[model samples]
Target: MRSECPVRAVASGSGGRRSYLVTGYEEARLALGDARLSKDTAAFFAGVDSKRRLHPAVAHTMLAGDPPRHTRLRKLVTGAFTSGAVAGLRPFITRLTDELLDRWPADGPVDLVADLAVPLPVMVICELLGVPETDRPQVQRWSAELFAAGEPGRTDAASYAVAEYMTGLIASKRLRPGDSLLDRLIAARDGEDHLDEDELVSLAVLLLVAGHETTTHFLGNAALALLRHPAAMERLRSAPDSLPQALDELLRFDAPVSTSTFRFTTEAITLGGTEIPAGVPVLVALGAANRDPRRFPAPDRLDLDRDATGHLSFGHGIHRCVGAPLAKAEAHIALRAILTRFPRIRLAVPDERLVWRHTRLVRGLDSLPVLT
Candidate 1:
């Protein structure tokens, strides 16, 4: 099973279309940020399968766009998560965190993913988007279905349902505008360069999915990392100032996202001395990239003080995660509070018994059992 190649040739889907599974950090970075490499595969290739079918709603995000449009769309709501905006949410986030912790049974066991990790992001994102409290469950259900990898049919239906729902949500925001990110985006303008209807809807899709899904995985992964490193946990609990650095290390140690958004080759080019022809797909493995020997010494070890900020957990280049600051704040607050309040927190079950989501795209546990 072992191979001796920097890049390996791989078959993609039913057709014989080729792809290179990139591993080296610098190589992957070069490939990912390269201008010749295109994110839109369908534009260059013939009959290539659109990965969007798996989660069309998520696909509608700025992730799917390139250059000018992507630039404009990301800029529209840039002010929404500004330091001031994030600071404003801190009070609400703290109250929400305390309420969740207060509700924790204080006895035997609980699934963190189910009880805290999932709902926190959902509620926060819903609040930011001004989604009604009553409508959150529906949104959560649609998101779950949309992220279901094996159930393509269900995912397709969920994607359509959410898109329809969001379209309505955007319309409502337009009519009864609030101070939410959605409303601000609708009203936002940069010298008359306003987002069109489709752009606005796409931005909404990005926010809704990213709001919950990525953070949920991050918190779960972070909890798992802490559970794996008891020494690190003890150090963190003893020195709470280390929480931010530790969180960054956790992100680099085992990034929640295994791969970057798929990059399709627009024209033939050489990468890492390998000639990759045009009309081919490429996936940059962030998990592998983070652990690359050249990038970090003792790559697998969780060093709380290691400079892990530049890690590709959020992504790289122009497509870097737009919600990174928000995600970081949420994770930091959640982890800090969990550690500070539940000083004796530990896993409810053995580590080996944990079940990881099989889908390679997202790295997360199906359930995180914990004891307080």
Candidate 2:
């Protein structure tokens, strides 16, 4: 409620986990960049042995990390994310999009979630990471387990499965290497930085999961938003050149992430006129921040021509998603190709009947049925 106060302390109903929710646009952006914030989230798992706690296999700390460590971990992989590198993926992404669409049901309702939105991103990421075709299904299952609303034990099991898989994958890469992203990361790991085996696995896991999951949500949510707004959809279908800006608007209108990753303050800090004590967990609501009327007039309306550049879809600061370029390229190719192939696409079912995958971290449709 930025209208009343930007920052409000809230408690979860499930775990009763206390967190500060920052809902204002400017406050959310600034809070994300606050130096007093620390990503070392082990403090959340209060009673467990810190060594045995959840240690993600990407970016060293998943979404948490401050400083030179975050700098070093991110730098090792930044070389391959240049504009040219991501642009180079255009042809591959286009080819994959066409191939996937070719297999879509030609005569009846099409479930975009299963047929296109889900598999396409996973396939692209799999190929990029050199994950074998046979193993893709298992990887997808593990990824779903981590994101889906489920019991804690089930999610933990899924996390362990993914970590163990990545650990083995990294070990194999050390003996026999290729030019894939995983191979490059392995080389960096073994290089002068002395990146440990665990960190190597973490990075791979992060890449494989984050690389496609958010993009999957972006694809699904963007499509649904476009379908709901026929004027914008028709405009993009006719003038595909403007699809990039349209995608940006779509992301802002309905951000893929509901909230930013947890950030705990290292010291007392004032945010949005609210003083947060040291070590309080913070949840920056990206979805709410994007819709702030102060920043975006008529925040509920989708305007393809609106200047939505500053939207937090890719986040801001060093913690911003490293795969933003790749994600944008993939979404662009996916949307453009869809428009060209299915110019008459529309929702197959009533909008009210659609169900959402309402997880704590991800916001996406369970299935998006469309007709062409």
- The digit string of per-residue lDDT tens for model 1 on 38-129 reads 77533553474555464444555687767877787777777777878888898888899889888888874988998888889999999999
- List the candidate 1 regions with Cα displacement exceeding 4 Å: 1-3, 41-58, 189-191
In terms of lDDT, which candidate is strongest?
2
TM value for model 2: 0.95
Error of 1 at 253 (Å): 0.5
**Predictions in order: lDDT:** 0.81, 0.84
TM-score of each: 0.94, 0.95
For model 2, how does the per-residue alpha-carbon lDDT over 57-126 read when each residue is reduced to its tens digit? 5324556666777787888777677788887778888998999899877764889888888888888888
Candidate 2: Cα lDDT at 4: 93
lDDT accuracy of residue 226 in candidate 1: 90
Which ten residues in a row are the worst by lDDT in model 1? 48-57
